[model samples]
Target: MSSMSAPSLNFLAGGGEMGEIIRATDWSGSPLGTPETWPGSLRTLVQVMLMSGQPMFIAWGPERIMLYNDGYAPMCANRHPWALGKPFAEVWADIIDAVGPIMDAAYAGIPTYMDDIEFLMTRHGKQVETHFSFGYTPVHDHEDRVAGMFCTALEITSEVAEAKARKADAERLREMFEQAPSAIAVLRGRDYVFEVANSAYQRLVAKSDFLGRPAADVIPDLLEQGFSDLLDRVYETGEPFIGAGVPITVTDTETGTTIDYMMDFVYQPMRDADGEIDAIFVEVADATERHKAEKMQAILNEELAHRIKNQMAVVQAIVSQTLRNAADVRSARQLINGRLVALSSAHDLLVRGKGERASVRKLIETAMEPYGRGDGRQINLTGTEIEVGPKAALSLALILHELATNAVKYGALSVPEGHLDIAWGTSVDEESTTFDLTWTESGGPSVDEPSAPGFGTRLLRGGITGVESRVELDYSPGGFTFVLSTPLADIVIS
Candidate 1:
C-alpha cells in the first residue's frame, strides 16, 4: 500500500450509521470541503441528529446539501443512501411544492412547527400519501448568521389513517340511523337530554326541535303518562323496558292540538366500558292503526257469529218446510239440495264482495253460470251498470239462482234451442227510485201455472227477510216470465 494519510475518525464520535458515513465520506470535490474542516455549527448539528432517537435532518450552505440520521432512512425509502450527498431540492423533489414554503420561512430565520401536514411522495418506486408533524429551526454559523436549517419530523401516517377510518365509521352509522324505518332517539345523562333524533323520530313528533332538550321539556304530556318515569327506572337499573299498544296523548307542536296515539316502544339503557349506565336508547313504532284494526276485528267477529246463527236457523226452517211439502223422499232431497246450493252460491257472491256492494251484472253472471253452457248462448243479460249492497246482492243472487235452476229443470233452458233473456231498467222519482227487472223464457214447451207455492216460489216472492221486494210470475203458452220490482235505495251503493 502506497503511503496515504489515514482518513479522520473524529466524526465517528457522534456514533450512528449517519455519523459513520460522514467519517468515511470524501468531500474533496464539494464546496464545503472535508467533514474535519467544516464549521463547528455544522458539526454540532450533525452530532445532535446522530445521537438523538428522533428522525432529524440538516440542509446546509447555499446549495442546501442534505444530511440525515438513520431514523430518517425508512421515510426516504429507496432514496436513502443516494440522498445522503444530494441537494435538498433533488432529494425531496416529489414533495417540494408542499415543503418549499416551510424551507423558505426557516431560511428567513423563522422557526415553524406544523402538525399532520399532508404530502405526496414517491417511496419504493411508487407514489404514496403521507402525513407528518415536524419542526424546522434555523442553524447558525461561526459568525452567528443563518447557514442552514435543522428539522425534526415524525411520520404520522398510521395515526392519521386510524383517525380517518374512525370518521368514516361514524358517518356510516349516522346515515343508517337517519334512514331507519322505526323512530329512534338517543338520550344522554340522568336528566335524559336528547342527543340524537332520526328523521323517523322527527316525523313522529311533527319535526319539533328536540335535540339537547330533556324529554319532559319536548313533550311535557309524556311525563303525565309515566313515560319519563319508565326511562328513569330503566336507566337506574341498567335494564330495558318494552311496551306495546300503550296509549299516549300528545299535543301537536305545529297544530297546538292534543291527539291520541298508541305506541309500541322500548327504553334501553346503554352502559359504558365500566358497566355504568350512561344513556338511554329509545325505539318507537306507531301502533294506532293496528290497534284500531284489532278492535274492528273483534266487533266484526261478534257480528259474524250472530249472522251465522241466524243463517243456520233460516236454513233449518227452509229444510223442514221443503221436506214437509215434498211428495216423496227423492223429491224432498232434490228440493233441499237445490235450495242449499242456491244459498251457497249467494253466500259466495257476498264473500267475494267482502261484505261491500257488489256489481249487479257480476251477481247475475255468477248465479246463472251453472245452468249456461260454454259461451252462454242460452241466456242473454242486458242492464246498465249498477251496484248493490251486501244484503241485496245476496238476496238477488239467491233469486237468480232459483230462477236459473227452475229454467234448467222445466223451463226454457230444458231445451237445446230454448233461450232466456234478462233485462233491467231504473225509474227515478222525487220520493224514491225503483229498479225493475224481467226474466223472460222463450222457445220452450208450453207452460202451466203451478197449483201451489213451492219453497223456491215463496223465496222469490219477497220471502227473504229484510229484503223489500215484490215479484210476479206469469205462466203462458209461449213460456214463463218473472218480474221483480225493488226500491233502489235498498240496493244502490249511494
Candidate 2:
C-alpha cells in the first residue's frame, strides 16, 4: 500500500496547527480500533518494508514502541532487536534524551535538521567522534493530526573529516603567500582590483593603501606606463603577457623625491570553473638598481675608449718629434723608448686604482718618476692633498708628463740651478668643486713665448679640455706658468 493509504493510530501525540494531546487508553476503545484502524501485523510489515536498505527508525505513540530496520538499527549506539517494541525512553534512554529536541520539533509539526553534528560515542571500547546530518519528520493520526516522529539520517563522518583537513591545507597555502620574501599581490576582475597584497607591496607604495583598491587607483603612474592597459588586455583575452625593462617613476615617500625604477613582470589570467577569464595575477621582479649600474658602466667604457685614443695620439706625436730632432736613428729610438716607459708607468697607476678615481698625489708621483727626483732643492712641491678621480687624474697626469718632458729639454729643470714650483688647492662652488693647480718655473734660461705652438703646449691644453676641464698656459718672462682647474666632485676616492 502507498504511504497515504496506510491507516493511522488513534492517539494524538503532540504536533499539528492546533495543540491537543489525548491518550488512546483514556478514550476507552481498542488501541488500533474505532475511527483509526492500525493493524499491528500490517504496521510491522510496512515498517520492515520502509527500513529495507535505508537508515529509518519508527516510534509509535502512547505505548512508544520503538522499531528500526536492519540497515538503521546497526548504526544505533549499542542496542539490539530484542529491545525493539519496548518504550523508546526505556531501552535507549540516553540516545532518546540527546535527540529529544529534534523529536520535540518534529512532534510540533516542524521538520528539524542538524547539520554535521559531532557525536562522541564509545565503539569497541574506544570513543570516537562521528559527524552526521540528522532529520526528523512527524507521523500523523487518522484525523491528520501529529502522532509520532520518524528519523532518517546517515553518517557524514568521513566527509566532515576531509573538509576539515582541506581547510587546514588552504590556510597553510595562504600563510606561504603572505610570508613570501618578495612582493605578491592578487588582482580581480577586468578592472584588476587589488583584492589582496603582501607586506612587500605595501613597502613600495607607502602612501597608498592597496587592499580593496583598484590597481590603477593606487598606482596612477602605471596607467601612463602601460601596465594597466596590459593587464586589462590579458584578462580580456585570457592570455599571459610578459614585459622587460619597463621604466617607471616612483615617488620616495620619505624623501619626497622622484626615483626611477626598471621592472619586469608577467600578467597571467586566472579562469573560473567555466574557463572564462575572471582575473589577472601579476608577478613583478624589480631590477632598477642593476639597470642604473649597467648604464653607468657603459658611459665609463666610452670615456675610457676616448682617453686611450687621445693618449696614443700624444705618444705618436712625441715619437715623431724626437725622431725629427735625433742626430742618429739610435738617439731617436732611445728617446722614444724613454718617453713610452714614462707613459706606461702613469698608466700602471691609473689601472691599479680600478678606474674609479685616481689619487692626484699618486698620478703626479708616477708621471715624475722618469725624471730623476730632480735635486729636491730644484723642484719645490707645495700643495694640500687634493684628489682627482680616474678620468681627471688621467688627464692631469698626461699634461704634467708633457710639461715635465719639456722642462727636461728647454725649461727650468733642464739646468742644475733651474727651479720649479707645483701647488694645488680645492674650492667648492654650487654643485661643483674646482681643483686649481699651478705650475711655475724660475731661475731657468730667460724663456720667451714660442712663435708657434708645439705638441706639448697643444696637448696640455687639449687633454684637460677633453676631460671637461680647463688649462691656462702663460709664457712668463721669469720662465713659464701653467694653471689648471677641474671639477672636484668627479674625483673618486674609492
Specify the highest-TM-score model's number.
1
Each model's TM-score? 0.71, 0.54
For candidate 2, the 10 contiguous residues with the lowest summed lDDT are 15-24
Best by lDDT: 1
Query: Clash pairs of candidate 2?
Result: 357-390, 358-389, 358-390, 389-491
Candidate 2's C-alpha runs over 4 A off are: 1-112, 119-129, 136-150, 205-210, 213-220, 250-259, 303-380, 384-494
Model 1 C-alpha lDDT per residue in residues 393-444, reported as the tens digit of each score: 7777767767876776678876678889999878888888888889999998
Write the residue-wise lDDT of candidate 2 on 167-220 in tens digits: 999888768767875566779886678987777666655554667887767877
